[model samples]
Each structure stands twice: as C-alpha cells, then as structure tokens.
Target: MEKIGTIASIKKEATIYKLTNPFRWFAKFGATGGLILFFISIVALVWANSPYQNVYEDFKNINLTFSIGSFVISKGLILWINDALMAIFFFVVGLEIKREFLVGELSDIRKASFPIVAAIGGMLVPALIYYLFNQEGDLRNGWGIPMATDIAFALGFLALLGSRVPTSLKIFLTALAIVDDIGAVIVIGLFYTETIHLIPIVCAGCIFVSMIFGNRLGIRTPWFYLIFGIFLWIAFLKSGIHATVSGVLAAFTIPSKSLVDGHLFVKEGKSLLNEFEVSFSKTKTIKHSQNSLTTKQESIVATMETACEYILPPLYRLEHSILPWVTFVIMPIFALANAGITIEGDLFRSLSHSVSYGVIGGLFLGKPIGVFLFSFIAVKLGISKLPEQTNWTQIIGIGFFAGVGFTMSIFVASLAFLDSNSLLTNSKIGILIGSLLSLTVGMIVLRFQKQK
Candidate 1:
C-alpha cells in the first residue's frame, strides 16, 4: 500500500512539473527553429551567389505534378512551398489566433489592448512607410512585405537573452506577434488575392459552412477536420485566393472543447493507473523474456491513453502535433526555397533601388517608430498600459524585434512581385538586410537594459 501510494505521488509530481515548466520547452523550440531557419537561409544565399547559381535556380524551378482522372495540380518547387506547404503554416497560425482570442493573453480586453494596439501600429507604420517610398508606381503593392513579425525568429532571439528578458515582456512580444499574424492574414485575403473564380469560391463557402456545422454538432475528432480542411484548401486554391488563407479558415473550425472534464479525467486516470500497477505484479509472475505487459495491463494502459486524448481539446492536440513539423521542417524548407537571391556587383547599389529602400526603411526605421509611438500614445491616452516590470526602452526593443519579419515578409514578397523577378530579387535583398539590422539592434537595446 505504501509503495503504491509513493509511486502515485511521484507520478503526480512529474505531471505537475511538466505542466509548470513550459517556458524551457518553448524556449528550446524557438531557438532551435530560429537557428535552423537562419542556417538554411544562409545556405540558400550562398548557393544562389556561388558559381552554381544555375543549379540553385534549377532546384527552385523543378516542376512537380499530381493528377487524378480529369483533375491536375502542377507547380514549380518554390510555388508549391509557398502555396501549398504555407497553407499548413497558416493553419497553425490560425489555431494560435483562435486560442489567443479564446483563452490566452488576448482573452481579456484590458490585457489584450496593449499588444493589439501595438501590433496595429507595428503593421500600419511599416506599410505606410513602404508605400511612401513606392508611392510612384506598382511597387506600392509590396507594402505588405515589411508589416510581418516572424514570431519564431523573434522568440528565438528573446530566448537567447535568457534571464535578461522578463516573462511579461515575452508574453507582450508573443501577443503582439499573434495580432500581427491576424493583420497579415486579413491583408492577404483582402488585398493580395488575384482574380477570383466564383465557382470555386462558392464551393469553398459550402465547405466552410459544413465545417461550422460539424463543429456545432460536437464532432471532436481531429481527422474529421483534417479531411475537410484539405478539401477547403483545394477549394480556395482553385478559387484564386492564395490557398494559405484556407489554413486559417479551417483552423477556426477545429473543436476547442475537450470531451472529458479535467476532474473526471484525473479520477479515471488514477484508477486505471492504479489498476495497471496492481497488474504489474501479475505480469512479473508470468514474465515473458521481452518484458511485455499482461493482457489486463495492456487494456488498462489503452483505456488510460483514451482518457488522455479525451481530456485534451482537438485544437490543442492538432497544434501540438503539427507545430513541431511546421517549425522544424516546413519553415526551414520555405527559407531554403525563398531566401536565395543573386546579387550582382555592388550590394549598396542594389539597396539604392526605391523598392529596396521602401522595404529596408519600412522594416528597420518604421517598425520601431510605429510600435513605440503607438504604444506611447496609447499609454498617454489611457487606452492601454505597459506590461509590468517592463519599461519604455524594452518596448522600443520589442518594436525593433518586430522588424525581424523574415518568413512572412518573404512569403508576401513572392506574391507582390510574382510577375517580376528583378523586383522580387531586390525585395528579398531588402528583407535580409532589414531583418539582420532589426535582430542586432533589438539585442543591443534589450541586452543592456536592467530589469526594474
């Protein structure tokens, strides 16, 4: 009896520790993802500028095709990465957005206001700055380029700062980035879309409505959403709506409610676990050389697994399963695909272009100014308050961090300048330069500041 009680207590403690120590887990994930992305980007850049530039181009232009009966889908490697894989990325973003609005930092109006307003400022000011520099021509379409905040990269930098960064500030930056994501999604859907096909749009609408119906019907299985979500992506893909938008829409349909209550789960889990423990002694008596569990013990374990699944909401489960893939695999592949740009002669001369200037100026100069200015005004106007244990300088640092708009900026650039390779190359150059500057300056600002 005493041994059983001790083992159970130890298990409970282990579970509590895991739940309470998410920061370390998240920090490792962010830093690893960021490093992988950075390394991949560097590799792509080197590969593009080397004598093998032709090889790099060939790699990106590699055509892939999938067909079924009368239906066919074909695209170059880069387009598939940007259009198809990114939709999965956007789906994860959508899940985070929904969770934030439902229960995370954005759940409370007062808590959400600071980051929300700051995000608006961060997005608008950079875009306006980009537009100002490109106001003369088609370059204005690229305004969306600098308005993104790469959360993975930003959080990775923050993780490097370690103990210097306060938890409140981390929360502030994360919330701000999530809001920035929402803005990006809206802008992409509204402004960046190409010509629309009504039949596909109607099909997408019908599918989306069915997804909502499924949610209302209390369907908690993730496979249901996953299957329908693929169809939704296909519909949006055919609708000319930049298929990634479907990711976000499908995310909103995932069931956020868990099937089992927390209390009931704990009760059942303890019972099953205790039963398994008792069966352990019996397994020892009938021991196989492989150390396999007895049938009764296996059944108890299976029931426990089911209970664990029931206790977690599908949205969380999906996010947990998919986020690691997005971070480590999809995003790094994206960086590899899109971060390469051939630079000829003088780099400064390349930067001299008005389009390049717009991107650099918008990201480096405008992002910090916008974030700080808007937040300051909100504080002064009593619309929002600064995060606790944080100061003005830290907010400025965060604003600069927001300027590290790598992944999404590159994604938007691909769309904005799809027709012109020269323009696209120039934009990629600006993105790389601007993001580097943001990362460095943000580090300097936050690194030197003392916590209050």
Candidate 2:
C-alpha cells in the first residue's frame, strides 16, 4: 500500500509540473489569442459593411465616463480602447523588452547584433520611403506607421509554413519585433503627444521615485506596484506624454528577487508537507475541512505562493496575464472601432495619393531591403552571425514577411494626417495591398526553398 501511494504521488507531481511548464503556457496563450483576434477582425469587417453600419459607428462613439469624488475621466469608447486598454498592452510589451534585455535573446551582444542592426534598418528605410513621397506635407508624420512588425500576424503566418521554416528563424523574427516595438514606443513618446502639463510631469517623476524605492526596499507584493502604477498612468495622461509610456516605466521597477531565502522555502515546505501528511492521516480521508487544517497548512500555501511569486518574476507574470487581454480584447476592439473606413467607388482615386504611395513603398519595398542589407552588414562586420540553419534565401524571405505592418501602420496613419481623408483612405488601401503581397511572396519563396 505504501509503495502504491508513492507511485500515485509521483504521477500527480509529474502531471502538475507538466501543466505548469512556462513554454507550453506561452504557446497556448499566444495561439488562443491569435485565433480570437482573427475572428474578431472578421466580425468587425462584416459589421462595418453590414446594414447596421450606423450602429457600429454609434457604438464606437459612445462616451464612457468614470468619476471618483471630485475627479473624473471621460473619453469616447474608441479612445478608451486605444489609450487606456492599449496602455496595458504597452506595459506588457515593456515587460517583454525588459526580460529580453536582462536574460533572453537580447542579453548577449553577439546574439543580438544581427536583429538590432536589422531593426534599425527596417525602421529607417520605411521612414525614408514614406518621407520621400510626403516630403512637402503633414503626411510626413505617418513615416513611422509602416515601421512596426505585427508579431502575432507574422508568427501566425510562419506557423502555417510548418517545418519549412527553422526555429532559429522564428527566434530571429521575434527578437527583431521586440526591437521594433522599442523603437515604436520611443517614437510615440517623443512625437505623438501635442500638449504638455508641468504639474503632472512632476507628479510622474515622484511616482517613479517611489517605484524605485519600493523595488529597493524589496517589496514583493504585486499590489504595491499596481497601486502606484495607476498613479503613474494618471500623471502621464495628465501630462503631455502618452499614458502608455507610464506602463513601460512602471514595468522597469518590478522587483526581480525573491522575498524569502531559497533554502528557507525548501526546508519550511518539506516540514509543512510532513505535518500535512500527519493531519491527513488523522482525517482518514483525502479531504480535510479548511478550518481543521493547522497553521502549517496555511503557511505552506503562503510559502508556495511566495515562491511562485519570486520564481516567476512580476514582469513576466504581468506579461503572461495581460497578453490575452491585449491580443483578444483590446486589439480586436481597436480594430473594430478604427478600421471602419467607408469604401466608395473612388477607392482607386484614393490609392493614387502621396500617402498611399509612401505607405505602399515603405512596407513593400523598404522593409525587405533595409532588414536584409543591415543584417548583411552586421554579419560582414563580425558584429553578429546568422543562425546556422538560416541561409541568405531564408533571410530575404523573412524580410518580405516583415512588411506585413497592419496594426502599427494604421495606428500611425491615424496620428499622421488630420484633414487628408483621401490620404488616410489610400494609406489603408496600401497597407492591405502591401500586406497581402508580402504574405503571398513570402509563402511562395519559403515553399520553393522547402521543395529544394
């Protein structure tokens, strides 16, 4: 009986560990979110063009307001989706950025150089391409729009290619996207906001100080950071800077260390488990009343929770938790609200505009050339080496795949032109056309390579 019980215990432990593996968790979350986003986008497109178009517009325009005591905040439903919910998205991005720099692919300069250089080229070429077409107009601000890589879309597309694409290539693509996000965040912070308030800026600074101090004081509870993070977000919103930047700032301050010593956790956990066993024997059943358990059982739960808190790291925990919200809920709603550009018979006329040409050229032409050329230079200079299984052909194919810039391009297009309705319409057209082209071209190239 004792031997049988030991075997059962071992099986249960193995099952628990398998369920909690981080890689499986990430892949599951990412896959589920991607599917949700894809369906949401389809629904949005259908609804926008449906007989209930007015209802769609009205829903997006609805004013949402919340007040506490004397303070109140109000925004259109669209703005709430973009500014508030997307702030959480950016916060998760910031956490990913911090994690990569600290320990992931970006931790080693040698490993990082290829993607870093490629990202710079990817960003610069797109901006230059956009500027060349819009040098004389307000459409210039839209240059950054095509510079982003929608990792979800890109990775999803890659997944369709199956074993044809190498694992190294996927890692490279992910790293490049991470770097691209950093650049986009910088641009948004510096160039997107139009007004400024000094008081809120100062308040943000104070909150930042508190966050740093909290980390220094070894505060491990997530609640400590969450409360002050809200304050930081409010301050940045009141200031001229975008509120999302506060998310990035707060992510940087999360403590990475464990509260209790590792040895203490192990020793105490074992002692508690021993006590739990004796208590379970007394009960003569697998179940014990919650109230009947001694303080040791409660202590075990607390210790285990604390150990998870420390082992997982808050930045990673937040990223994992928030990814689903960003991909499934926030991004889809943003698309539904923003992607409803009315199509008319004059869609061709819109496509002939300078904004259209800039967006098309930047994404379709500039992205591939820039990413490939810069990566070549980095390899030549011995700053970075290409992954072993990746060839020049694969690199070029990946470059084209990088051109699918739907989300970020649309976002920047909104910010870039105010009165140029024709320009905005054309830019969307360009994005659709260019992204489709890239997808087709990339798949063909990859398929051909695989056949060889």
Q: What TM-score fits each model?
A: 0.92, 0.86
Query: How many clashes show up per model?
Result: 0, 0
- The residue-by-residue lDDT of candidate 2 on 209-316, one tens digit each, is 999999898786789999999999999988988888898898889875555677876887687678767866767665555336557666767766766676666767
Clashing residue pairs in candidate 1, if any? none
Q: Model 1: per-residue lDDT, tens digit, 1-452?
A: 76688789899989998987886666456488888789999999999999999999999999999899999999999989998899999999999999999999999999999999999999999999999889866788899999999999989878889889899999999999999999999989999887999999999999999999999999988888889998999999899888999999999999998888889998898888888878786666673533467678778888988887888889999999999899989999999989988898898888999889899998998899999999999999999998899999999999999999998899999889989888998899999999999999999999999966
Q: How accurate is candidate 1 locally (lDDT)?
A: 0.91
Q: Model 2: residues >4 Å from true position, as ranges? A: 1-31, 260-302, 418-420
User: What's the residue-level lDDT of 201 in candidate 2?
Assistant: 98
Candidate 2, residue 210: lDDT: 98
User: Could you tell me which residue pairs clash in candidate 2?
Assistant: none
lDDT of 2: 0.80
Q: In model 1, which regions exceed 4 Å deviation?
A: 1-29, 281-290
